[model samples]
Target: MMELRWLEAFVAVAEELHFGRAAERLHMAQSPLSQVIRKLEKNVGSPLFKRSTRTVELTAPGQALLPYAYRILRSLNNAMDAARSAEGVPTGRFTLGFSGMHNHDTLPRITRALRENFPGVDLNLVGGIRTFDGMRQVRNEDLDASFLGIIGDVGTPLRAREISRHHLGVVVPTDHPLAHRDAIPIHQLRGESFVMGPVDGNSSMTVAALQICHAAGFQPEIAQAVSDPFLIVSMVAAGVGITILPSEVLPILPEAATWIELEGDPVPFSHGVVWSDDNESEPLQAFLTILDSIFPEPTLQ
Candidate 1:
């Protein structure tokens, strides 16, 4: 029978597309990795990869095997997690994803409440590329849940529980002319050298900012592309550029920058907790209950 270890080696290699790099990722030697791949191919009666000195490509069988391998491994891990939860030890670990955009006002309260109520649960928090990435991960059973800002059409697939809303705000340097305004019109930002995050993938902030800019009648002349929203303040303070973000980010504003409310509700940001339709974990259910206690009128979809 083909062993799980052989599948693990194959998956690692397939993902990395290089035996040496895959070996390093697995913290094993190339010799052993090669041995395992060969053993797997021999056991399956076919070569899973076509390798040259420069590149590694998956064979048809390899392509067919990857998804099943991932699903099997995930199922095994889930079974183990379930077994641990059922051991009568009264201790469990629940992993949830978090984007930096979550509300500071409620998360601490939520965490504290969870700790106080479920003393046995170790609330595992993982950071993500974006909130929507968490939704994808949840669907894959990689996470139990996540807290993130939902944007247009991105959170449609996952079951979203609305936690809070944060209207868009303009983040600018203290000395910038717009800093003096109570709020600024979107089109007034035309021709400004804006700092933007990547809109590719599930980056809602970037998508919303660009959409707002387009509505305002021009594409922003981007000065810098930053990944983290918190870092945008420093860039703005350094006179590199300005950015638009959610009102929830106000607490993190440095002395060099301040926020002005946007002129209209162009595109507002909503904080939501997302999970897969398949998730029915106890810890996740407990979390939903605590969330209900905190925000009673929570909207679910």
Candidate 2:
């Protein structure tokens, strides 16, 4: 029987594509990590990696086995967590990180559920961080999970499931020319200035707004880049510049500003939770169980 440690070695190598880095991540010497890969490949009767002095790539078999490997490991973790839960209430610590739209209906409800269900587990809610920071922290295990406003795939080693989707809208000063219109095409704002969140990967909103403008065939003239969504709206209200945002921020819009839908094909904007598959703490599992109850089904964007 193949040991679980071998699967761990396989996944680490497959993700990093560098035996040295993978071994460092696994805290094992490069020689033993290489031996484990060889052993796993032999048991499967195929080479898993095409290794070179500088480049390492997964073979076809390795590619095919990757998803199953993730599932097997996740299943084992879930099974273990279940067994532990049967003994008594779970007691441990879980830290959750979030960026943008912290007041979204889904997030508050999830936190409330966690407090109610796992009172024995200490919960730490960290907010105001950016999406990229949250992703990095979750992968590094500094946080058990992160709620993010992501523009694209969450990528490998980490997984994300959508919490909710939002429609794109334009926030303009009540006195602006476009304010009277119920909706605005992105192209109309080509020469207009925009207020957006910081571009330092902290704000997925900035990326989403830029992408919308790019699709409309122009680069936005950014007037300001601030971190707070509320502040972004306030800037627009004070005539700093108009801005694009997800509809979820509508409630916070002051009377000085109005939100108009983007008059075009819907752009995909999603809020989701991100976590590493390698974190198997019972507290995390319990928290995830609450999340699963809320999301119920996987959302594919």
Candidate 3:
């Protein structure tokens, strides 16, 4: 039987296609790496590489074995992880990032479920990170996962699973004329002054607000831009300007502002969990399993 280390060496050399670079990558001397490759080739009864003075190329047998080597290594890693989890070994700390746009009650529930299933895990919850920043963090392995309100593309090496959809609404001061109405048509707010968060390219809330306004056939007039969500809410309550927000976020604010349903077919926004597809850590896998159990399907809220 071929040893796992032999496959490891084979894969490293096969991909790098250079004994010196592969040795450097494997943290060993070039001579030993070459010996391992020679042993592997002898075991297979076929030459694996066409070695030259300046270049090393994979032979036909090496080409056939490269993919199998990758699969074996990956499977061995998964098996080790599974064994560690089954033995209840501490999976270590996990960090979750969010932008505070998700449902208020959802975070606690997710954390609680993970704790119940894996008591050995240390949980760290990070909030107030913008969606785009969170995406970058996840891709770079700074965050294990994040609750994202993605309005557009999710980018590569990262995947998203949507949990809920929210309809658009408008928030106005209680004393504002539009606040007295049960609902208002989208086009009625055409000339109205709006207060919102800064126009960061990745802010789902900002993009959703702008899209709805443009869909209504008018560009909104901006009065102020604030970074803090609560500050934006305070400005609206102080009669600085009305702003558009998802209906789910309206309930958490002070009662000084009133939420009016938007008339007409306004575009809905999505809220979901985002994580790096490349992450195969035990804790992240457990967290994802719990999240899926809690939110089996996307609900329109």
Candidate 4:
């Protein structure tokens, strides 16, 4: 089979019909350009050019093959472009896994960064996974990667880099007596009903809250099992119950509810970026590079 370079020379010469011009267009010496066309003609078992000192012309076979040459070269160029689309380039889509809080807290920034730098790459946001499920989805290739709030030490096959560590806090109605305090002991809430994620809530925040309550020496009275975090805050604001969440939740707390610091030794809640070890796509790699730059290890303030 003839190589692409040879066909390229043949096409250039055919189009220009002038050795000097073709050579210049190809950025090659006239002698080599002539040789490449001759080699192509020999491979095709026909003369491709009718040449003289003053000019050159494509023979009948050359004319017949010209369209084929153009098509083949065009196809090859398109194939090369397809091979280069990082995540999807020119126009590509990247699937990113995001859990509840990170959708607002983290994903928007990352998606914006990627859009600005790589406008061709669309960041597909997949949400609603609980902490551990995010890790599993990333490992299983159901998601390209995820930002998860890990509650405790959990082993995972996916690669992870913690973005932030949050100290636990209590969100209570503004009129509540404890809400006036700057900080409160977890144990002090023993008599209070808890508004929390469902017992089956997939969130690490939920697990951490339950664990903190249990560690405080009591099983909280379940005021409600609400999955929507903001709604949980609404319930608290309505005085239905108080709840424990990360300090980061302070920003989104309703006016009726406020976050109080946990007064004691801390076992922090951490949000991490997790991805499959087996994922090696160029686009995914590019996203990972950008992610590391923006959220380098232990950059928690």
Candidate 5:
């Protein structure tokens, strides 16, 4: 039978491409590491490495087996992590990702709640450009979970639970002509130049804004495209141009800017918790439950 220990030795040597270094990394003697590789090759009935006085290299067989070895190691590590997390003690370090719509105030409350409720758990937050990358990171096991924007068509390979929604509004400079208005009609800004978010980063919002403009009979002349909300609002405050943003962002608005309710069709922004369906953890589920309770939909007055 081929031993797992031998396979691990072979993998280490294959990765390092130097037996002495691989032995040091595995904390084993070079002689034993070489013996394990030879035994592994014997069991497989093929040469896994080609070695000369000057160099050591993987043979064709080694190349083919490297990926399988990596997969096995990853699976083993994940399984161990899962088993430890399943103990229900909630004492493992986990990374949580977020992008777009997570208010600065709300995140602190969530962090405090996590600290209070799961005292044993170590939580790390990773913020990204937007939901797409956050979702990808969670699904790929780079993150334990993430808060993401629910917009356009939701992609596959990720499971999401709606946590909250906020109304969209227009942000303009305080001294701008539109600031005096309680709400602005979408059609009224048709001929004006606008500062906008990145089309790829905020694709759903960008598309919706374009469609609204198109329906109103003119295309918005985009003066600048930015990825960060703070920068976008800063540019607006400088009289660059107005932008549409979620109402929750109004509280964070710079002193030079004012927010107005959007008139006509209501464009709602949705936020959700996302995680990998295949490797759901007890800690992740607990975190999600906390989020659901904290941000329950408010009853319309």
Candidate 6:
């Protein structure tokens, strides 16, 4: 049977690319490390490393196994941590995820609430590259909760509570022709060069921005597609192209960029707190309660 220790040894050797360093890292003798690798190879019926007097390189098989080994190790660590956390009397330790776009505004208040109300809880905020992936983590119990934009698609097994809404707006260069306009009509931006975010499944902002352009009767000519909002704003500042972003982004706009509210019934973006139905942790519940108190649902007239 392939042992976990052997896999660990192989991974260390593969990463360090030196038996001596790998052995030192594992706090073991080089001979035992070499033996472990041999055993692993025998078990798999294939050599994993190409070793010489001065160099130790991964074989094709080793290269292929590297990603699986790392993933397994990460999963094992997460499982052990989760087990240890659950075994102890649940005092507090909340892990939250957030989309990078929403974190600037929501993180401070969330952290403040956790500090004031659930002082015992260790608040860990993780930034995610994509909203859907972050939502998946929340649903999978990897994250206790997350704040993400309201994705019309890619439904999850978690419940979401709407917290805030922001209007869509255009970010243009300060000296641009439309800079002084109170509100820019979407039609006027047709065929205009744009700096946008991921237009695929990852970002709702990108999808909505494109939809607005298409509705205005012409597809936007994209100059760049960047994932980071700050980078998108910076690109616009550099006169790359105009960008459509949430109004919340106005406060963080670069000095060279000016924000203009989009005229007509522009699509508003919403961000919300999400958590798994199966996550019954007291800290998570307490955190949710704090969120409810801080940002209560608005009563419509």
Q: Find the candidate with the highest lDDT and give its number.
A: 2
**Over 4 Å off, model 6:** 1-92, 153-156, 298-301
A best-first ranking of the candidates according to their lDDT comes to 2, 3, 6, 1, 4, 5
Model 1 lowest lDDT segment of ten: 84-93
Instruction: Tell me the lDDT of candidate 5.
Output: 0.75
- Give the per-residue Cα lDDT of candidate 4 at 291: 85
Q: Please list the residue runs of candidate 4 whose C-alpha ends up more than 4 Å from where it truly belongs after superposition.
A: 1-82, 86-91, 152-156, 299-301
* Whole-model lDDT values for every prediction: 0.79, 0.84, 0.83, 0.78, 0.75, 0.79
In angstroms, what RMSD does candidate 3 have relative to the true structure?
8.6
Native-to-model Cα distance after best TM-score fit, residue 260 in candidate 5, in Å: 1.5
TM-score of each: 0.79, 0.69, 0.70, 0.68, 0.73, 0.70
The positional error of residue 150 in candidate 6, measured at the CA in angstroms, is 0.8
Model 2, 114-180: lDDT tens per residue?
8898886789988786788888888766688998886777887899887777777899999999999
Q: Could you give the C-alpha RMSD of every candidate to the true structure, in order shown?
A: 3.9, 7.8, 8.6, 17.3, 5.5, 5.3
Ranked by TM-score, top first: 1, 5, 3, 6, 2, 4
Q: Mind giving the per-residue lDDT tens digits that candidate 5 earns over 1-104?
A: 97778878988888788888999999999998888988999998999999998788999998988767755765665566568767666656667876544547
True-structure Cα RMSD, model 6: 5.3
lDDT of 4 by residue, 170-283 (tens): 889999999889888888999898898888757888888888888889999988997777788899999999998777777777899988887887657788777866555555
Off by over 4 Å in 3: 1-90
Off by over 4 Å in 2: 1-86, 100-102, 296-301
